[model samples]
Target: MSSKLRIWVTGASEGIGLGLLQHYQNLGWQTVGSSRRTQGPTVADYWIPADLSDSADQISAVNQLMTEVGWPDLVVLNAGVGHWATADESARSDAERVFALNYWAPVEITRLLAQRAEGRGLHVIVISSIAARFGQQKLATYSASKAAVALWAESVNEEWQGSAHRIQLILPGVVSTNIMRHSIGRDGQALGDRAGAHRGWSVERTVRAIERATRSGRFAHILASPGVRLALIMHDLCPSIFYLLLRRKP
Candidate 1:
């Protein structure tokens, strides 16, 4: 692994992506951060602009970068949107939008990169949520979308079994970020205030874990917080009990 490896971070304008960029920069790594709206810090050697939701634009952005900077050693698919809704309250359009960004977009980008970097040592990092481990009340759509991403990563990892490219899935528990404030709820409301109360891991802590995992070349699914790890173990040990505890109150 190169000390000054080139990295591409999607959703780099804020949240975990932004924190990761800052941390990597501090470690003297060259990075390119992408976002749909805000431009990333110019301090980065390259800032490839992109909107993951826009498939054509995202492909073009990557092509442009490859023409200029060659293929990135690591690509962090960190951009995502969360929407929570009860099964009965969820709208078709809401589910469509969530799947488009949270699942399809990353899958498309990963496919494109894998095809282009056939024999290269490429690492693709996916930022899935711990909610993916099991369905959550009022978070059906979000959880399902994350589950799709996680399963996709697992499939891709298997497909690249004898290849140099690798896929990594990161399951992060609740983090104090603007994503909570922006996440849509069952009744199309924001969960900003409510999510703040569910304390788990800090963005810095998750970012550090991501860096460590990437450096260690670990391809297995990773849980960023101990709470999530414990929850997963319990869920596996006693599914009925776990489901009962996770059931939503009416």
Candidate 2:
């Protein structure tokens, strides 16, 4: 039998990253997990410990990852934080931190990984959000950051088409994650939300779509369920109506 494919996932500590890690691990992939901590959160074949919030740590982590694996067949850029700050309550630093993890970290690490590939085949999967498509309610910074990464993936797919890399931009609707609660919930808590999180999709559901898309050699996957996809479509087709519908209740 052929050797199992190798993968490296960032933000392997929890949520979507954790889901992907566990799935791939169970499938017998030669997987490596990276997070701020060296221990706990998961048991992978290998681990890459690096806090992506710091540039030095990021560079070190990438260097260490390349040293250990040379280049993984696939790199899942899934590490990010959830910020809960109102427009008046939020600070510039908070937004910057979100952007650092969500946008810049992924870009730099992916850049290093792509270059390391040296024209070999590579799959780059990014876990973005359906929130990327809409500027709804109070998640301005979070929404913007997700949108930024999605846009970056578009440009990357354009620039690297004939090269070693193919990018997967996944825009998943609200999943039952703490990060989702933090991003969509009020007072930074879901509060048993009627704001649609109870009906939010599962991490497994989202990751399965990712797997399917990857197998098909596709570049984009929007894993929004029927209603969610409709709402997003409506948001695009009728921005004014969506603006009113998506806003929180008074």
Candidate 3:
């Protein structure tokens, strides 16, 4: 058996997943990165080129990983997709695609692995977002999807307590990534650029926060800065007033 700690990360082609994979690799851990992209620049000691959005792909990828790497010490179900559309506009399209990848797929994959594993210690880290706390204007489905994952992680954590199985949810605020590129604005154009989506926390900074939380064995980690957390707190405490004070658009 490999003496080094091994971790499997999904959605490792770009953004937070790529960042985390590289960080662990630098720390000398055996890292596996899974994504639809296979030919381009890749990190980690191993790569599983598969699209997690498809059930067959998810199954094939996990089975291949199991065959090649056996049981990983940690599994990061970071594969997700985001869209920016209002409820009215979203009705025009099939929302199930987003829901399937962002919510159901991760839950299914984790459940399958947990059920199959024969008493091997496992820690699952899932990427959620601060948007999950409540409904956001341009993030109706995105928010709901993340919220579903976070809630599931929490329930699973409780269910597996005092056992080797564990789940950790990392909820991030706005981070600089391509996710914002696909967002539709209130003006029917791209919304991310105007909202300063490209100016949020850096990939490295966000990864640092996640690592810190993992070391502390916390159940949840919100990757927003202190100021953002305060705003969320104010909104939670007085949502009506906050709603009146805040604007739906940038």
The C-alpha TM-scores of every prediction are 0.89, 0.88, 0.91
Q: Model 2: residues >4 Å from true position, as ranges?
A: 40-42, 180-199, 248-250
lDDT of 2: 0.78
Residue 136 local lDDT, model 3: 72
Q: 39-147 in candidate 1: lDDT tens per residue? A: 5676456777877788887788779767877788888999998886688999887788788888988899888887788578778999998888886767889999999
* Tens digit per residue, CA lDDT, model 2, 186-244: 34443243343435678898777777877877788888768778888898899988888
Tell me, by TM-score, which candidate is best.
3
Residue 249 lDDT in candidate 2: 40
Candidate 1 error regions (>4 Å): 1-3, 186-198, 224-227, 247-250
lDDT of 2 at 36: 86
Higher-TM-score candidate of 1 and 3: 3
Instruction: Tell me the deviation in Å of residue 2 in model 2.
Output: 10
Scored by Cα lDDT, where does model 3 land?
0.82
Candidate 3 residue-wise lDDT at 112: 77
Residue pair clashes in candidate 2: none
Model 2 worst lDDT run, 10 consecutive residues: 182-191
Once fitted onto the true fold, the runs of candidate 3 whose alpha carbons sit more than 4 angstroms away are 182-197, 248-250
Computed on alpha carbons, the lDDT of every model, listed in order, comes to 0.81, 0.78, 0.82
Clash count, predicted structure 2: 0
